[model samples]
Target: MTLPEKPASGAEQPTMAELAEGYASKAGLHRSSNGNIDVLKSAGGVQGIAESVLPGLVFLVAFTITRDLPVALIGSLATAAAFTIARLIQRRPLTQALAGVVGVGLSAWLANSTGKAEDFYVLGFFTNVAYILAMALSIAFRWPFAGLIFGFIRNEGLEWRKHPARMKAYKIGTWVIISVLVLRLVVQVPLYFMGEAGLAALATTRLLMGAPLYILGVWVAWLLTRPAPAPADPGTERS
Candidate 1:
């Protein structure tokens, strides 16, 4: 019996490379025809931004007007559901919508159980902290997560790890990302602790910082980590 055919030599890539490609794919970054990173597409574009921000915006507005937790929660859930339904109608992927639903549902549950509106933002803090620590660890390991992502997007594959300059650029990019998360906490955590009184401010900051700030931070990181163009060949004749 033929031993299971050994995988083709070209198909034999390290598992880390495979994982990094998958992670980068999910980042939604794409190169434009001119080879610039499409920051809006990376942030999911207009549809993606609306999907992420609208539910929270709805909840905040509803809570502010009615000052009723259940009503605000229901409004948020309904907004999330509406996006899910829209995706279904458009035959679009439901991953973003469904994730939004789950997040809003969890936040609603937390706030409802504790009978404090501020708890809705608590889970976000934990999530940010988790990301900060994970990215920090990746930097410490010299496997800066930004390199994994940018390398994949730039078609450099995993070779960036072998180049010290590229590795340093990616590390700085990763730190730029870490700073964004840290900024979110620094600006919002105080508002979160202010309890319901601060709910409005907390929710406002969350909306402002959610997708817009993320896009800005990622754009900056992408710029900072971009590879320098190769020097022009002196022997090449000009047209």
Candidate 2:
């Protein structure tokens, strides 16, 4: 009997560049047909904004009304779970919703362990510091995180590293992002120290400075580091 033909190999895995591009795309970075970065989409649109804000908002409202840490934690976690379940029912990607659930769960655990409502927000301070340090290191290493992100979004690949001007622009962009994280710590840390009395203010500022502020920072960075327009060909000029 003739030997059976070997099966074809599965599709090749994506290259690092392609993987980076995919990540940037999921991060909501996209250039419109008109060549403008879609800031609203990058901010994950309205549904995404609600996903990022609602859990904390629920916790704040619950605590404000009842002044009970356990009730507030339950409310927050429930809000996150509702979003996750809705995503599952709709057969949509679960990444953002699941992250929200995990975050809420962790915050709940911390606050429950400490018996302090403010401990719920303690995780967020560490998160901000981690991001700030990471971005700062990327800039110091001459591989600004902004370059890795925006470069892929703009399809510049790693070529931006060859040009000093491009490098300077990306470093600036990275600093802009770092600045946003720093501002969060600067404004929120004080409120966190006020303990339960500061919980309301802490939660309120966290909501205000969370996704909304980050979007603004990214928008500014995009504009600042945008590639310069190509020079017009002299031959194409009107006679």
Candidate 3:
């Protein structure tokens, strides 16, 4: 989680291309089915999903029932903290649990401060928008996110971009990611603008589109980037 250090003046600094390749390669190792499953388990799996969704659910339900911001915010923060504590007691990695606590805590703070329930979803809405723009820009520049990632994973360097087939595959994979993000915004943005009801809907949308959709996106990317069949040698063909 620490930021990278600056290279010394006399040292040859890594280019952005090299850094991007390294990052993509590292990311690919974690995007596989087994790797993702392990991540899910480390994150507390089904229980983790519930832990993530329940705090917001509690806030929404409490607000709907009593119309009290303090009560709702407290309920959400308390639930998130409880989940984090439970994860710690179980000796599981705290990254996911801590993230849940931080996210819920921040959302509650924003909503309470603004006296607007919709502010709870503002962070997530902006996050999705940021992702969409990043992915789109990468593809438009012909350095598609998926391609860059898998190429580095395979240690193929920038060579994949020179091949029309591989380039097309990566482009398609990047589009899959873009499509999911766009769909999320399409469904949730209007809800984000809807006031109290929108807040509730936005929370629901966030839960629905969270990890499951991400896993699906990974699967689609893998399918598109799987190794292609090698061409037959001319000498092997009948004369």
Best by lDDT: 2
TM-score of each predicted structure versus truth: 0.88, 0.89, 0.73
- Residue 230, candidate 1: Cα error in Å is 1.6
Q: Of 1 and 2, which scores higher on lDDT?
A: 2
Model 1, 76-169: lDDT tens digits are 9999999999999999989889999999899999999999988988989999999999999999999998887788777787899999999999
lDDT of 1: 0.87
Q: For model 3, how does the per-residue alpha-carbon lDDT over 1-239 read when each residue is reduced to its tens digit?
A: 99998978889888655664456534523433432223454234688678867888888889889989899889999998998898888887677778888888888889988999878878887888898899889989999988877676555667998899888889899889788888888998898788887776787888788766765776677677876878999988976
2 or 3, greater by lDDT = 2
- Name the runs in model 3 displaced over 4 angstroms: 1-44, 152-159, 231-239
Off by over 4 Å in 2: 1-21
Clash number for each model:
0, 0, 0
lDDT of 1 at 237: 50
Q: Alpha carbon lDDT of residue 22, candidate 2?
A: 80
TM-score of 2: 0.89
Worst 10 residues of 2 by lDDT: 27-36
